[model samples]
Target: MAFTLSIPRKRISASPGQIVTALIIALFLAVFLLIPTGTVIYTAFTEKGTGALTAINFIDFFNTELFRRSFFNSVYVAGMSVVWATVIALPLAVLTTRFDFRGSMIIQTLGFIPLIMPPFVGAVAMQLLFGRNGTVNLLLNDWFGFRIPFMEGLNGVIFVQSLHYFPFILINLSASLRNIDRSMEEAAQNLGSSGFRLFRRIVFPLAMPGYLAGASLVFVKVFDDLATPLLLNVKDMLAPQAYLRVTSVGLTDPMGYVIAVILIVVSIFAMWLSAVAMRGKDYSTVQRGGGGLTKRKLTKRESLVAYATVGFILLLVLSPHIGLLLLSFATVWSYSPLPDGYTVAHYTRVFGESSLYIKNTLIYVSLAGLIDVIVGSAIAYLVLRTKLIGRRWLDWAATSALAIPGVVLGIGYLRTFYNIPLPDGTPLATLWVMLVLALAIRRLPYALRACYAALQQVSISLEEAAENLGATKQRTIRRIVLPLMTGGLLAGFVTSFATAAVELSATLMLIQSNSDAPIAYGLYVFMQSPAGRGPGAALGVIAVILVGLCTFLSHYVIERRQKTLGAAK
Candidate 1:
């Protein structure tokens, strides 16, 4: 009774290093993510001339017919693109995962090919294949005496976007299909359900989470896409309108900020809807290590039909790459099914006169990738290892960059940093560093996901063991965790570098001088002139090769790491 007055002990605090790291991450996010985004939001609401909050910006956006059309057009195109993407992806996923077919691996590989090419780069090449007088049209005319307007006006934007983004749906749905409990299907079949009925009632509902996730992403991406619409000359969309307003009327244009705000709002709403749709629904299966959905062996007729269907789709998917290659060497390719002449002059010219572009790309993307890995690793450690409060917000903030359109971020940077002077007495907006920073910001989510995934796989006991052996936290991270995550770090770096090298929306806004333009801006400039298409195509080919090589290297590293882990076990 006398000893009952004991005090509760306060929880042990985070280590100093953990505190410091957390502070640094918060500051980094504040400076890089929140401030720029806040700047855009702030500008969107303020009166144009007087700096007072007003609804006139939004009112004007609604009242103007052009702005209204652009807004609705974006919604229309994004909706149609998602629908078409689902139509294309669902059948492909079903064919590949539900049936045993030859070349399934090849089909899956072809699905991923579209991701390697940026939509803008592919937009030009796609036009060569699907345009009015292009290869597909020429073939159609000869075979059936007619041509389809696949690449006409808004239809063109929807078509290119669907092809470029359907892979997201395919990959997600395929994984979902694989993870589904086979017993459910068996039960349904025993009750006389089969074929489309079985899929409609049982399988599809179970895969709803994955399909919704991919569909939401596709909608957000297509809604905020500036490059594809610009490349396809479909300017009656929200993203393109935002870009044109900012560039034409200058940063003080409230309409551009209004559009940016709308873009961000739509993207966030789509993601929230997707999350809410999956909430409170149990899509989980009880099966732990048992067999998954039973794959049916296709009959001879089914096999032939499946192969032919997949083969035709694969041809369309791969057409962009084929078009790029053909255009790169073509001396003249207009109004014909094939290039009139072929030469290496385009390559030589690209190397000879525009060699600076390659150099700039190498330097900027390498630095951006390096920064991404460092930041990504630090974030993963803070969130996964430390008991620090609000650490998860750092991850959330970083990943939220994914929803922010590149054009919006670019406009934010242009407005936010336009007046700040650099050490060289030039505006910060004019520096090459701004371009590098923008690329890093835009691609940070990719790098963060990779690093976070790698870090998650590492056992916490390894770090604890190092700490128990009297090693400092920093030393333990450097000596133990960093080595194990090297493969993931490299993969993240390569992904960041490859994607950043093709970034156009932000680059288009921040590039003040032609001398400082990266490969993406250079390609855009080249493609703007009819005579420069050869050089543009040549530059695009180089970009494709670089990305392809990096992708292969990443795969090799991952496979080797898996093998090493397996052997150690």
Candidate 2:
């Protein structure tokens, strides 16, 4: 009644080295994730003296006004950011993908910049431009005789965060809108439906899945964020305060840890929703033809309107960065387009006062990146290529990190890891584990992406052939699968390294005095230092260089991999 394992539908066989590859991946998850996660939960439930389970921490957490305010702030900010990102992204996706526009490629690429850079960078840039004594403020006072405090606390966080994260919406929405069948839209119009009606009834529903996925991701991202609120000085939010309560205060303060745990739970839940909503949905077809989008070219006047719209977008996105560059170089605060005085002083202080940060940045980023590539690849394989039971949970765990805010994870790790009893019943803790785990977990999405890209290209037939020749699955994979996925490995390696270099929020909480402090964290500290803007700018420049160099290296590696593929074929 049942088929034997000996028979195959199409000469099925495990690839050589598949077992070893799988084992390596399995071991990775066990070491980095299974151990820490297990430890966190274990400590949370049991008190030290009694070793007894307790809901007392949860009760205390509820009673804390700090946490209560933060919870509300986080929810409000997440919701508002979602709304803001959508308002910006929807129209951009529609115009760029659905209609013909001048400079489309340029704008699209520009949109991606925010996506690539971490959210903290956006917050820092915002402070330089829009702060109380920001460049805009000084100019207004000089020219208009009055200054406006545009960078209000909670409002500022929402403003900068929305802009930085909107690209997720734009990129995903464009993919969704492009996937819609043009025939349906055209048919609706022929039935006397106007643009609004056609979009509402036909286009909207079809794009719903993509929008839901994108929105879910954004919600997760906003909910988990730590740095934006901190740098923006928004006391109302929960993530940073929760982190402070643990690190600056005490780990045994179960109240803060409880709040941190809540943030993690909510973020993970939202991302789970995202993964479910977008399952099996592809969004690149909002256009009519296989060749390109089904765009109706605009008339002369219409073209002008499109140009104007595009210009406004560029302005909103570019101003903060452009302004930050000015702020970095300005000798006096609130200077004009060209600073009244310019000096290399900021650059000097950063390198001179804290040159160690540069080295730390490189080390953490490269090591964490290497970890991400090896581990991420294995996890991706487990989820995508294997028949392993409960592999889906692996995807959830890895991707779930994407939903956890850097700050929340920071506090969670601190609260969770700090309490775990080590050998000799002492607290076994250091910045190394914290930094590595922080970078590795945060960058999990990129690592998975690399594996996903490679696996997509390697058909099972190739893997089967290696197996059919009586190659042990492990050997077959080593000789076939690993080599085939080298490009993805290279790309993944480069990505993890680069992101790790600039990663902040979690890095900040993880950093211990005289142990490990990433360049991004150092930059943040110095930026607020009395040594003035001099050292801070230097740190920023150094960070930019380190990041840029690694970015180039990753791109170079990926490019070489592409060339090798072409040559082999």
**Number of the top-ranking candidate, with lDDT as the measure:** 1
Residues 183-228, candidate 1: write the lDDT tens digits: 8899999999999899999999998988998999899989998988
- The TM-score that candidate 1 achieves is 0.96
Q: What is the C-alpha local distance difference test score of each model?
A: 0.89, 0.70
Top-TM-score structure, candidate number: 1
TM-score of each candidate structure, all chains considered together:
0.96, 0.84
CA displacement after TM-score superposition, residue 90 of candidate 1 (Å): 2.1
Give me candidate 2's TM-score against the actual structure. 0.84
Please give the range of 10 consecutive residues that has the lowest summed lDDT in model 2.
Answer: 10-19
lDDT of 2 by residue, 1-569 (tens): 99778754553233445445666665666655555555445555666468688877676666878777888888888888889888878777777887777777788877766655556655665666776677677778889998776678777877787887888888877777776777667777889986677777777767877677778778877777777777666766777777677676676655555666687788777777667766786544444452332686788997888778777876776665565566567686543434578777776666676778777777777788877877777777666676655556666767656655666666556655666667777444454766776788789778788877887777789888978988866686688988889888888887888777887777777777644787778766755653455456556655655666667677787788778878878
Model 2 residue 221 lDDT score: 73
Query: Which lDDT value does model 1 have at 422?
Result: 75
State the local distance difference test value for candidate 2. 0.70
